[model samples]
Target: MSTPKTTVHYVEDKINSWQTRSPFIILFLASLVGVATGLIGSLFQIGIAHIISWRMGIADSEFSNIYIKCLVIFLITAAMGAFSYYLVKKYAPESGGSGIPEVEGALLDLRPVRWKRVLPVKFFGGLTALGSGMVLGREGPTVQMGSSLGKMLADTTKIKNKESQHTLIATGAGAGITTAFNAPLGGILFVIEEMRGEFSYTKSSIKAVFVGCISACIVYQLIIGSSPILNIGTYISVPLNSIWIYIFLGIFVGVIGALSNFLILSTRKFLDLFYQKKEYFFVLTGALLAGFFGLLTIFLPDITGGGFLIIPNVIDELYSFYPLLILFSLRLIATVICFGSGAPGGIFSPTIALGAILGVLFGICARTIFPEYDIHLGTCAILGMAGLFAASIRAPLTGIVIVIEMTSSYILILPLILTCVTATFIAQTLGSTSLYSEILNNTLDKLGIQRK
Candidate 1:
């Protein structure tokens, strides 16, 4: 028989051993989340591509009646949008809109993660919304769904620790971003910067994020190939003297980014007046918006979709200044409408496209004013991509790293840092809140959850 002191010591040792091993368990789970997110995200991308290609192929097929072809396309896209909206309304309202805010809320324990509903709802709904040519991104759905998967694993595996749950959720979110953009470091930085407040940042948690990001990237590359998302030709180093122009561009993007945020939030609020938490009204609004975009996509393809296709054209100067300006204006409006209407998509790619447009416009004018510098317009476009993201998201590091990784333009780091930092500083100075934070606050308010 053991003495009382020996029994107590034995129990202490057992507890200590479990405590030491628990982190490894959590890390292993995080890696699993990463692999799952990567495969799902890749499949999501493939599905969207097939849908888009099928739609375009049909549109281009030799048909006797052109008007009928157009009509058929519009009807098909509109139906897709309607179906996606219906799913969100009936099955998972929380899956509507960019799911990033929801993940952030979940991390803070301010929201619940119903993965069974969210996974299916976000996956299919996002496919429909994106395929319908809405100015939305896949990243939002991927991140939300990934985080939901993490939560599902935790619950199923009986991970009772709150901190562990938070870490896994964040890991999945980071991995989702990695899979979406093929930027592992950017994904890791996203968790650190964008989700800073909610992310635990413990040694084990950070390592888990790393593992998840790497795993997600590996899986994504195996499926999607290792090419950068944007294949804009390599840009030469920006001249040192032209750094001032980037600063000015940064300031410009800061104002525009602030304006963009205001428009997005304002539009969402206005739309909410009609929705009033009525599922039918919300779904109807989304469908109507989708229908409109479907028609627009058939006509002005430049301003529709998630904005990736437009970036290369913009960087290549395919459109002159006037047309670029017009495209930018239209896309700004489309982005606000699609995102504010609560489509199951993200504003991230749209925002980056806007920045590229704005940067192109600025570059055009700059070249006209200063012919001596012979500035590379592509550089400006690149800077704008990071600048606007930095200002709007208030996550400059992630923005910079993302731009660098996406473009493979590490030589432009100095200019990127200058522009992104300036944009973020100006946006903050102008009293603009980070986009995700604003969205999260709005969500919590709607749910009547008070912040601690």
Candidate 2:
């Protein structure tokens, strides 16, 4: 009996060794992560939309008075903000901010994973914060949550190898982007460009990221259908002579981008002062600010949410120069306030919207200034997308690819590249740190803020 058991164990070990070394098996598992991430991310999006719409329905009716509406929106948003804060304060403080930093930190093994706590806290907490109408992006939270899912998969599979662990984390991050944008290439580029420091980028890791992004995209399309997130119609590219305008636009965006980063960091510093010892007041203030945005949504409508709805409107020449300027100014302030409040949303979408508005304004002004040079508003809008993203995040390649994917405007690649490069250079020269890393450092300096 002992001899027979030993033989069986030896055979099993041989089989396990072969399976572990099989490239195909690794690829298959990575693809599995993609599918899971895509499905989960899509569900997350759908869930958030449902919640937002439901809340809006309640706010739109029965609260006819502007003052009353503002008050109610404020209270509701405050509660949501407070709830999000409490979750971060209690369970996974590293889950706060954009979450991309935590993902990066995880790759460096500087963070600990309590996915059981973070995954739920970020998901539900994010929903509450985002649904409250703060000017936050969903992509950041989604990335964190998706990566957490990857870690979960690794744990369940008993993957002990460091290489496999890195591969899986990359898989989750790629899947998160794919699910968010339905752009597989963009998702992969995100890992390469935005999280380069955290990424190992071995052949194996690259394959895993590729597999995960593609699978997530497939899953998302199966559910949401393969359509660009923004349904902007066909846009004619700017003429070669007109391309210089985009370069100039990029330079302008660089200055604004640097300023924008400064403003955001400054806002955080200011808000931190209020929240440091006064936790309840801090939470309440966040709620009140969200409520204010909620009321503004009902009244202004253009200044609320993630700012996606406002992009097309800004680019379509629906408003004149002065009005566009006003919109830009107000939205910028609102964006800073909403984002600085420590909500579980992203600044990506909002920054895109801001850039679009700036481009449109620049286009209108340039066209008026130079009648001989025909300025394409749509082209400006696209450039704006890349420039703003590059300026704020300091990741030009990711910004360019993401905008292209979101708009399905591959024809603008040259201008996009030029503009993104210029924007990134300008922002970097001005000395603004990458947004996610900055946020992560902020969270870490606070004692008890453990990242994973």
Q: Pick the candidate with the highest lDDT.
A: 1
Q: Model 2 — TM-score against the truth?
A: 0.92
**What residue runs in model 2 are displaced by over 4 Å at the alpha carbon?**
1-22, 62-69, 444-452
User: Which residue pairs in model 2 clash with each other?
Assistant: 73-291, 74-291, 78-287, 137-346
Q: For candidate 2, lDDT tens digit of each residue in 1-452?
A: 56988999999888788866755666778898888888878888898799789878867778557777767776776677778777877788777777887788788787766789988888888888888787888888778888888888889899898778877877888789878877788889989988887777777788888988998998999998899988887777768987877888899899899999889888988888877776576567766776677666677878788888878777778898899899999889988887776677778888998999988888888998888997888789889988999999988988888899999999999999999889888888888878877876776776456554
**TM-scores across all candidates?**
0.95, 0.92
Q: Against the true structure, candidate 1 has what lDDT?
A: 0.89
Clashes of each: 0, 4
Would you list the clashing residue pairs of candidate 1? Answer: none
Clash count for candidate 2 is 4
